[model samples]
Target: MTLSSSDSASLPAERLGGLLQSASFHPQQTIALGISDLAEQAKEDRADKLGISCAEEVGSVYAAILGAIVHRDAGLAD
Candidate 1:
C-alpha cells in the first residue's frame, strides 16, 4: 500500500522511517516504488515537525541513497 502525497508529507519521521525500512526489506522493486512515492511527496510538501530542518535533512539523505540505488540499477549512476 502506498501513501498519498499529503499524507506522506504530514507523517512523523518515525512513521516514515518505519515505512521506508519496511519497503527496504521487501523486493528491490518495492523499495524503488517507496522511494519514488516519498520523493514526490517531499516535493509537494515537507513534513511539519518541531525540527523541520532536521526532518528534511534526514528525508533528503534517504532520498539520495534510494535514488542512487535506482539510478545505478538503471545504468544512470555516475
Candidate 2:
C-alpha cells in the first residue's frame, strides 16, 4: 500500500512493521474493523495535531494493512 505524506510523517517507519505483525494475530474481519477504527482515530489525531484532514493517509494505511493480512493468509493457505 502507498503511504501518504501525512502517514509517513505521523507513523514511524519501525512502528509500521510492528503494527502489521501484531495485527496478524487477529482474524481478517476483526483486523479490517480494527483498521477502520484506527483510521478514524488517525484522522482525528492528525486533525487535532496538524489541523488538516488525513483521510487519504489513513485510508492508505488501512488498505496496506488489509492487503498484507490477505496476502499473508493466502500464502498460508497454499
Candidate 3:
C-alpha cells in the first residue's frame, strides 16, 4: 500500500522496536500488531496490501494486488 506522509511518519519498524524492548512481549504478537498497523496505513492511503492504488491508477492496481498475493501464496514448489 502507498504510504501517506502521516502514516509513514510513524514507521512500523519504530513501533516494532519499542515493542521488542518490552520483556513480556512475543514475536507473533509483534508481527500481528505490525500487520494490523500496516493494514491501517494502507486503508488511510487507499492502497491495497500489495501496494496497488486503484483510485489513482484504476484496474491495474487491483490486478497487481491480486497477482502479488496469489504469487506469494503459490511460491515455489514444495
Query: In terms of TM-score, which candidate is strongest?
Result: 3
Clashes of each: 0, 0, 1
Best candidate, lDDT: 1
lDDT assessment of candidate 3: 0.64
- Candidate 2, which ten residues in sequence have the lowest lDDT sum? 26-35
TM-score of each: 0.33, 0.31, 0.35
Instruction: Flag regions of model 2 displaced more than 4 Å.
Output: 1-26, 52-78
Clashing pairs in 1: none
Q: Write the per-residue lDDT of candidate 2 for residues 1-78, one digit (tens) a residue.
A: 444578646665565555556655754654465457678878988778764346667888999999889989889534
Per-residue lDDT tens digits for candidate 3, residues 4-78, read: 568546776677566556525565666567678778887877655345543557677788888888888999324
The 10-residue segment of model 3 with minimum total lDDT is: 47-56
Tell me which of candidates 1 and 2 scores higher on lDDT: 1
Error at 46, model 2, angstroms? 0.7
Candidate 1 C-alpha RMSD relative to the actual structure: 20.8
